[model samples]
Target: MLNRMSDHRLAQLNIAALKAPLDDPALADFVALLDPINALAEASPGFVWRYVDENGADATAARPFGDDLIVNFSLWADRDSLWNFTYRSGHLDLLRRRREWFTRMAAAHQVMWWVPAGRIPTIEEAGERLALLRANGPSPEAFTFTDSYPPPSAPPTTAETGTPETATRAGAGLTPPRPASPSSS
Candidate 1:
């Protein structure tokens, strides 16, 4: 049996196209919440690392993907850690209001993958994963919360049961209820 406590970490990259300039009055609310929300994430359990720009600011102005896009790239101990922080923490507040600040993307804008513990992925690598997901749909190499794959080191059978494990340990069969789509901001 696999150790199941693999030393791999889960990495996530999400991009959102901005509806207005960061300093624009239309975005004032979103901008104002950035620092507090980021602080909350840093203090959250299982928080590992987040991408910051040269000025030690959030990666909003990095523009690695496009001039109008902001990226959130981070790592966690496992999918459960990431899921908890994303859904069970203050992050959900922002996520609920995303359309107020971001354009509705026609394609997938988030991707998740596994990396060796302590390894940080580059922006280019994140972009590649997103591209792969868009082109190939979900795979073990790149996936989404709705269609996730297991970590490479996961055991074939559950530790508590001799039966084979058929679903991801994190999120399992729970799919988030998609909020009604609001027109792009």
Candidate 2:
């Protein structure tokens, strides 16, 4: 199903714990590949914005989970746009190589949510979403790619599993006001 909402953009946060510092020889390859991968994301269709450090470099230095963990926070036109870039583009190989440079996170390391277009989510807001995912699993508030959620703007009927029904005034219990025959003199 096309889970992406038209009225909202998708915001995503991916965190990875580093096995070694970026300058370490063991992590050189991973470090070297970051620029290219980031460039690919920027060039991809539907990419909206990405969070960068004050210097405007990659987000690797913006570690919310202390010095060891890194964040990649960005916004896309929708889920499909991010899915295509992360899985279908040339970045796939680099992504698979993550095991070499990053440690396995105990809980979920990625969280995604829908936000109003042109809105930039603060790191604290994203951290809360990540915590929510770790504590509660996949909810509409915060979710993962494998288990995504539609935006709040989705049509009410389609958001849940139910046969579509057209309710009449009688069904809804709102009676029309009785028409006055004529105003009493």
Which candidate's lDDT is highest?
1
lDDT per residue as tens, model 1, 110-182: 9999998879998899999999999999998999999987777543454565655544566256343366989
Model 2 alpha-carbon drift over 4 Å, by segment: 1-5, 154-185
RMSD of 2: 7.3
Per-model TM-score versus the true fold:
0.80, 0.79
Candidates in order have lDDT scores of 0.84, 0.83
For model 1, the stretches where C-alpha displacement exceeds 4 angstroms are 154-185
Tens digit of per-residue lDDT, candidate 2, span 31-147: 888888888999999999888867766688777678988899999998999999999998899888989999998889999998988688888889999999999999988999989
Instruction: Determine which window of 10 residues in candidate 2 has minimal summed lDDT.
Output: 162-171
